[model samples]
Target chain A: MLKAFASYMTYEFIGLDQGSRIGDVLNFFIYDTIKIFLLLTVIIHAVSIIRSYFPPEKTRKILAHKREFIGNILAALLGVVTPFCSCSAVPLFIGFVEAGVPLGVTFSFLISSPMVNEVAVVLLWGLFGWKIAAIYMVTGLLVAVLAGFVIGKLKLEKWVEEYVYQIKTGQGQQVLTQTFRQRLQYARWNTADILKRIWLYVVLAIGLGGFIHGYVPQDFLVRYAGNGNPFAVPMAVALGVPLYSNAAGVIPIVYALMEKGLNTGTVLAFMMAVTALSLPEMIILRKVLKIPLLIVFAGIMTVTITAVGYLFNAIL
Target chain B: MEIKVLGPGCANCHTMEQLAKTAVAALGIEARVEKISDIQEIMKYTMSTPGLVVNGKLKHAGKPLPSIEKVKAMIKEEA
Candidate 1:
């Protein structure tokens, strides 16, 4: 009797009982919140702690001191370790411009930072094999580096707000002093705050993912977006422009979509669209960059992500 | 120890913060963590909140939590 009662309670808490018609939706929302919470509290915190050592202001100085090509390369490398999120895009943009980093190089860093990260890499490795993950990383890095180089040659300096030109470079490094115990506390609190902010986005993304996971028609996707579909790659690229979110948020969806028969190229295109040209990130960028620069950036990203996606689909 | 996570409480920042705590707990370290939601305060640290500072030194920000061993090493080195 006791064991049976406990099992019943568990179902009730998870809302898995047969009588609960809302169980699926509620369960999904709860699952997402917890997943986002765990991700925020643990994965993101560790990354930030490491990031504290390599401040953006310092990165700008280092890159500025190097050759243009080297600067672009180093910037992409630094992007992997730095703490650039959707929210910080505008300020970082200002900081980069003020520090005299070329616009194209900065764009490369900006594009890569969100589209690829350790978390996404690890998650992708777990979901797919290492081959796909490796392909994703290499292709993503290439897109960012090449796009930035191309844009750099075009000289879109006029697109920047005049105020950005006046911003100073090399702000003094800010360091926090704390014992091991204290750093832990800082991490915990940040987790709570971050989870609160993006939990909804995570849930919505995951919920759509779950539905696709449970019920998307695979044959249709294969017929339309499979390796053989010539038009699928371009179509996927165009579609990525309007949808927005970072790589972290989109990778899971990619996994779910792939499980439902989505092709690698199509998934890659979606991931790029959502990562590099996120609507939310762009909206945030609007505060600093003009429409022309934003359009150009978006257009370039769309073409590159599409091409890469198709190329990977063909090769891998 | 003074720790500051800069952001308006986005998911990534939150995860980084949480993982920091988990690392601390697993390692048996006790500490105080502060969350900075205000844009002005965060701007004081390169406009990056969800940022981590150990002993008045900015150590990490922007990405998710790293491996526990690495974080433990960083804390010990700082000490």
Candidate 2:
């Protein structure tokens, strides 16, 4: 249906010539935009409902005081389902820390939370095939778990702000229990909220993708960031660090890069690097984590994300 | 009655505070609505941001701010 509409709009309504570049790009943009938005709405609403059950408090409870190996695994998985934003990072961090949750486990949650999400998954699946999307998710989780494990072993607790240890969160915290109807309401609002925030990014991304598909020559970036380039993955990760974007916003850009002959590993590395580490998020985290711990976290993330990019590039 | 809105001052936090103020006025209730942005004080109530505390008791926490009706209902419960 979407394909048919896109075709009709491009060929019949717009009256562009067959096989014309403008027609092709217009078709691509129209079809992908509508299709992706539809996918995003449905998936985001469902994910919101599912996420309602795993609030940060619950996620913390699930991992608190658990053993390290299993804890990192659970934290990574929970990070995907837990819906807390970076704004709540400090309290969430202090909450987890005060609850005796392992710092590494918390790191796993922090790493995976922003980088891997339903929106990113939906965007990837919509643009790329399911296999690529699956690969991205699995690798993201692995990086989160592994980096978190390494951080855990580093025993850098002292690097955290001293105030995080001394400040005791209030007990007898009241539970603002939601009814099923309330959950549904929350999901509806969440879907609207997410769409409002990212719709512009999605549209711009798809627009750029269409433009690239029509105008950009093939192998444009392959020479610089192709599989043959030994430094491509590291370089891509390095470029991605200062830039900030959520997974949804970056996937289309990644798609454009992938289309322009960038190696899969390099582009994917760039996407992860952009999402995983951002200047704003680092500053927000700085309130609780001292500069050294933040630096170490950033370093490990850069290395792990770069490795994942290289691994996938080599394999596929 | 005193009600506090706890958050680290994100966009949603402001909305939450607004919803709260509007709820109090619509109900015509004499309640002090306080905005709590201090991280240490916020953790004393809830781990999540944009938390709603009615009379120092947590009523709602986290995103997807409750409807004005719901806020009024919560305030009514405290009243």
Candidate 3:
């Protein structure tokens, strides 16, 4: 139905020439926009309902004092369903510390939450397919886990700000309880909230993708950032670091880049780097962690993301 | 009565603070709605920012902030 509507609008209503590149691009954009928004509405609402059940307080209780590897893994998983905002990073970090959750485990949660989100997943699935979405998610989680484990082994607790250890989260955390109706209400608002924030990015992504599909010549970027270039992955990560956008904002750019003949691994790495590591988040984290730890975090993420890009480039 | 808004001074935190004040004034209640900007102080209430504390009891915390009506209800409950 979506496909038919997209084609009708492109070919009949707009009267773009049939079988032309512009028609194809328009169809792709229209079909993808509708499919992605619908998927996001359903998935984000469901995720919000799940999130209402597992607030940060409950996640803290579940993760505190667990073994290292297992804790890191659990923390990364919880990061996905837990609704965390960058603004709350300081308190949440301290809360984790106060709960006896290891610094590394906390890092895992912090890394995965922002990078692997429902909007990104929905967009990837709608545009690329499930396999690519699955790859993005699994690699994202793996990167978080591996980086957290490495941070754990480094024993960088001393690098944390002195005050983080001293501050005690209140024991009387009021458990936020709501009725099913309230949860549904929250979900409705949550979906609208997410859509409002990312609508521009989605539109821009699809628009840019359409432009690329219609105008940019095939293999345009292949020579420079293609699989043949050994430095492509690192270069992509380097370019991605300072640039900041949410996953939704970045994926369309990824699609455009991939379409222009950027190899899969290099494009994926660029997306990960853009979403996973950003200067603003680092600045926010600076309140809890010292400069050195932040540096180490950035370094490890860059390396891991680059490696993943290369791995996928070679295997897939 | 005391109402405290806890956050590290983000946009949401400010909105929460403003909501508490409006809720207080609309209720015609003589209450102080304090904005707690200090992270240490904020943590003593809840891990999530934009936290609402009614008489030092955490009423709500985190994003997707409660509506103005809900904020009024919380204050009324404390009142």
Chain A TM-score (model 3)? 0.97
Better-scoring candidate (TM-score), 1 or 2: 2
Off by over 4 Å in 1: A1-46, A169-217, B1-45, B49-79
Determine which window of 10 residues in candidate 1 chain A has minimal summed lDDT. A1-10
Candidate 1 lDDT, A104-144, residue by residue in tens: 88888888888777666655564565777787778888888
A117-232 per-residue lDDT for model 2 (tens digits): 99888888888768877988899899999999999999999999998898876544556678999889889999998888888888888898889878988888887777678999
Ranking by DockQ: 3, 2, 1
TM-score of chain B of 1: 0.73
Per-residue lDDT of A73-116 in model 3, one digit per residue for the tens? 99999999999999999889988998999999999999999998
What digit string (tens of lDDT, one per residue) describes model 1 on residues B1-79? 5555556667767776776676667767666666766544555565554566555666665544445565656655665
Model 2's DockQ?
Answer: 0.67
What does DockQ give for each predicted structure? Answer: 0.16, 0.67, 0.69
Better of 2 and 3 by lDDT: 3
Q: Chain A TM-score, candidate 2? A: 0.97
Candidate 3's residue-wise lDDT over B4-32, tens digit each? Answer: 99989889998999899999989999999
Candidate 3 chain A, poorest ten consecutive residues by summed lDDT:
A167-176
RMSD of each: 9.4, 1.7, 1.5
First chain TM-score for all predictions: 0.75, 0.97, 0.97
